[model samples]
Target: MTQLTLDTRSISRGDGLTDQAYKVIRDAILSRRLAPGTRLSIPELSRQLDISRSPVREAIARIEYEGLAESVSHRGAVVVEIGLDELVAIYDVREVLEGLAARLATRAADDAFIDVLERNWQAHRDAVEADDVEQHMKLDAAFHRHIREGSGNLRLSENLRQLQGQIRVAMTTTVARRGGMPAALAEHRSLIDAIRGGDPATAEQVAREHITRLRESLHDAASAERHHNNERRKP
Candidate 1:
């Protein structure tokens, strides 16, 4: 098992300047620090991050390509808000790609890979038990990343990493509403079991079901948020 360094702060340092800026901004978006629909001003970002506008502009362009941001006609770049429709579309794609990754991982993974997964699963369970939502989310992301890498497909891993940013936002929103960390842990366990069993069909089925449940939960949260905001606005 490789020593997993979970320092998200330094994730940007290893890449090029523009790439590093992109990751930093992307991480903020994923973690909801930037929030959905937030307008990203290049000058503002450059000042905040103590970098030049050129790199920030480059970063925004890359993020736009990833569908995490959009280039407005005159308003500049803005974070892409995940609507119910986008949520369904993204998860549908995730189900297929993640299931394929799991299937490939099962065929290629050795006992060590399984052990690493089990350890990650246990850590996730512990985080849930402790009611540490942040840690739980981080572990959950790591666990999926491990599976993608273990799949031995560079393209699959890259695609999953890109998609992961969007998924994180939805996951964070859902967790904030439902408060069901234990259920999420159980789902992870089920996913691991299906992969370990070497049953591609079962793996795909479970993956889709898990993502579908997540989408439903997020939809419920979004609806509740809308209702709450409406009431607040009334009086």
Candidate 2:
């Protein structure tokens, strides 16, 4: 429910064949163009990208290491499927990681960086006011992205980024995760204030609470959906 990790940069045009293949495929997976459990047929992918099979295979190997794909016995590599259980698991990890990111960013972020957070906050507010769902979502995503990167902890940033990248489907696809945004924006405002105030304790608590709040919303929604489906299926 936090990242979709947004800022998904495409593979730049100029790069080595293997790296290019890897990036292209990685981006596709992150963007959900290649959905969970979809087959990654090397020869098919090679033809689609108009590249050789070797590079495609190499790309599969890299993504598998990143937890985006797994090699099945005969099915070859397939994208990882994200269900509610997986979604909750990811949010569980992310809430803690994001709390640390906010706490660290309070100490490390400069005024200029805080200015960026303020600007992003205003933009997000505008998006909410205008009822522009896409822009609101993008700004919401960028808000956390700035905090994570601004944390000045490279290892923490990279670890969260990777965890998010591999499981981003949970962010985009589930209906249960949909109802948290309006309230989440208010929580974002609190987090921004905490960071700007340079209180790491408040920042971490606010950050963790923000995520925990959304987690409850999504869980209730998912439970409702399952109950509805079960009732409808009853003969």
Candidate number achieving the greatest TM-score relative to the actual structure:
2
Task: Give every collision pair in model 1.
Answer: none
Model 2 TM-score? Answer: 0.83
| Local distance difference test values of all predictions, in order | 0.77, 0.77
| lDDT tens digits, residue span 142-216, model 2 | 888898999999999987877778557555432225454567678888888888788999999999988786666
Q: Residue 214 in model 2: shift from native, Å?
A: 1.8
TM-score of each: 0.79, 0.83
Per-residue lDDT value at 56 in model 2: 74
CA lDDT, candidate 1, residue 143 = 87
Residue 141 lDDT in candidate 2 = 72
